[model samples]
Target: MTIIAGVALLLAAVAFFLLPTAHLNTRSLVRVNGVARIVPPETKVAGLAELEGLQTGPGSMLDLTGDVTVLGAGAPAERTLSGRPLDPDGILPDGARIVVRHGDHVLEAIRRVTVQIPYETSVEGKGVIVSLVRPGVPGERELFKGVASGKQAAVFTTSAPQNAVIERTSSAASGLKLAALTFDDGPGKFTQGVLDALAAKHVPGTFFVLGSSAAGNKAMIEKIKAAGHEVENHSWDHPILTKLTTEQIMRQISRTEEVIGGSRYLRPPYGSYDAKVTAAAAALGHKLVLWTVDTRDWETPEVGAILANVKAQTKPGAIILMHDGGNNRSATVASIPVVIDWLFQQGYSLTTVAGLL
Candidate 1:
């Protein structure tokens, strides 16, 4: 009996040594911030302190209320557990992803941008002879932009734009019995007839020729010049000067100047002009010339009506508008002689616009 009891006791001791304890059986495998770690069975809930010690390298204990410095900017740090906000003493789960992000801090700054200010024009005095009283100047303004870190800027304040002022003065009518004969859109087929009429009467006139037309009709331009008539700019293709930008206006005037070798006067198409056109013309040393009388010759009016329009509108220091080209100008070609004769008969001297001025 003693021998049997000894055997059973020995077997019981062996069995107790081989079986696992409750603490060892409850051990769990968990990931802390993507790292594998073994949590002891005694730690039912884990916090930042427990995770900090589990980290491979020595690091500061997680501070819930401290600022984090990132890329020269300081802001509060945010802690998360598995994509959700982590409480100061929250439970940590197995296979959880932990993330920490710094909140961006806002900063204020000023930004500057340049803006173009167009000039303004003020015309004074009367009559056809115009002179510049004051030249124009361009101005600028300041724009203040408010910006925040990692955000778009907003405009908070802007200075008013300063506009340049330009002034022009004109002379009163001279009251002398003198009228200026001006032709437009010319250097074409009917140009010779008009030139012959002016040459026969020994009178000087102004011919405002288009740059395109002048480039193609070089001989006609030469004839107009040789006949003692003034050759001026009528633009290239005759666009409304007011409708074009400043650069476009400059191109139109400068191209014409280059083609005709330059002129001091420009007659905008359809008698159109504005502050921008005036400034552009002045930049190239050209002056704007407009007519005091309209013959409406472009409408193909009757020769008698054309002559009558001339008779009524002709006055001292007047610029008479006519066209030698641009379509069906036979009536204008026929009225040339009669217009000159009546002007002479009415005791009006026929001369170029420059001469009248």
Candidate 2:
């Protein structure tokens, strides 16, 4: 009995010492996404969620533990982990390699933006008369784009652009020695006297008459035409064409054309024009006429100043501006004979606007 008890005590002492030594030598190694770590013996790791230093989300992971592989969670979406689908909560064994794969997914975001659309311009006409047909307007559009990876594409256009149209004349050639004497706001009290002055000089002139004036003085218009003068259109009320809308502009020009019958020219009041005005004139088959020499006769300047203006600015292909009837024109009528004689003495042959062109 004493020997048996002694043997049992020795066996207990050996077992205690051996157990501690074995426990100290044992170690657990785990590899996460190819990174290796040593863990305490008998350490329990419950799936990828329980793993330390792992970012867990709606994705996939691979568990290669002891010749067994498991692909866990999520498919091929944005930021998805690549592997066969498996249970993410399954326990992991020692010496296991856990591969977390972030697969591709479509990321979406919505934003509103304003984009500018530029207007285009086009030009027409080849005369010494330039006009703007249409002022171009810019356009706008909204787009919805889908981006995959790093590429972008246009979705659609919300508004289309409006283009501008311009009409212009080529530059006049030099040294032509041609001059056009033009009268505006005519068929008034002094119109006959002005015509008498031109007839005395045997010169041809262009008369831009108001529709209202021409309507009242139809006989005078025919008489002026008989005197070999060119009668053309001046606006009915003579408002600034640029300030008027397209419809108003058309009315102003068309009414004058209707009254004047066969006139082919339009001299906008105050020498002002815009795209709408020019387009309206062109649509009525009228060419715009502007002056090179402004006598400022409407201001009733001195006859000498008016003559000086004519002489100073007259050139080849010159269009001289004079007013016969807008206001009291005793000065204009008086200056007419003197101006015509001076031009003749300067070796200039006065002609109509059409003749000058």
Candidate 3:
């Protein structure tokens, strides 16, 4: 073999041997019950803030932040850059920060917490109930896990409540007199404007809020209600429902409703759903209402694109799709006037989804 060829082979062998042994001492810790709890490396962690300036060396420190619980939500527990847990196995909140030390680097992390759901049915025909309680110190925040065991053979906990239902809704309007407008994925900053626009036009519409967004903005949610628009359930995380289990589907409905807790009618995210997805919703007394018109405002940021999409698609009894949240909605908001004006010119009367059917 040529000398260069032999050298290449030698380097390849050296890299293969060295790569497997290379690993930074990465830590995964969270606040539980107001203390920093070091989540084992084996635990799955998808929710953590970027630890840009944290110290992670032998002498690093970590400070607990917020409510100081191990399982609560929001802001990482603050930690000084030190290698030691100030009070090991202590409680910490959802957003608490922690520090670890490795040489001169102080490693840091924040709790990436998601709400735990109760009593979800799996797609495979099984039941799951997540106990808000997890084994931890006194006053430790409750922990949430994605995959929960069916029921503890040793003991079972109480069940969650059924989702709220729309008791008596107005008729789905006769002859499509007024064009009822509907917006999904909202409660965003622009939501107020959309509300204002509809109010100006004397139009009543429906808002399908994603569950997670609802939790983040309660004031806006109340405003949507106060604005006289119907608030309805969107999915929990706005993921494509078909990929999730029946229980997950219910969680999408229940969790969204978990926040809104009332107001029936749900428009699926991305117009995404299946028959099974519907059954999961029916179990919660939610009716699946697919939009007859999709403005597709989510596609381009251009207002013209939004207007064209809506103008091309909207028809009578159409549950036209637009959004007020989930990324910038300037385009969607811009298109509203175009669609409404056109519909009005076309002699379509505006009404709310509840009013429509």
Q: Is candidate 1 or candidate 2 better by TM-score?
A: 1
Q: How far off is residue 26 in model 3, in Å?
A: 92
Q: Per-residue alpha-carbon lDDT of model 1 for 148-263, expressed as tens digits?
A: 32222333334443343434333234478888889999878989888888888898989999999999988888878887889999998899998999899999999988888889
- The Cα RMSD in angstroms, rounded to one decimal, for candidate 2 relative to the true structure is 10.9
For each candidate in the order shown, give its overall lDDT on alpha carbons: 0.73, 0.73, 0.61
Report the C-alpha lDDT of model 2 over 163-281, residue by residue, as the tens digit: 87877663253256667788999779989989898898888989999988888989989888999999988888789998998788888888877887867889998888656677778
> What is candidate 3's lDDT per residue for 116-216, written digit by digit as tens?
33323222221110111211111212332222221112222233323322222223553455446778887788798788778777778789888898899
Winner of 2 and 3 under TM-score: 2
Better of 1 and 3 by lDDT: 1
| Residue 332 Cα positional deviation in candidate 1, in Å, after optimal superposition | 1.0
Worst 10 residues of 3 by lDDT: 126-135
Question: For each candidate, what TM-score against the reference?
Answer: 0.63, 0.59, 0.50
The TM-score-based order of candidates, best leading, equals 1, 2, 3
- Clash counts for all predictions: 0, 14, 67
Which whole-number lDDT from 0 to 100 does residue 49 have in model 3? 26
What is every candidate's alpha-carbon RMSD to the true fold?
A: 10.1, 10.9, 30.0
Query: Best by lDDT, which number?
Result: 2
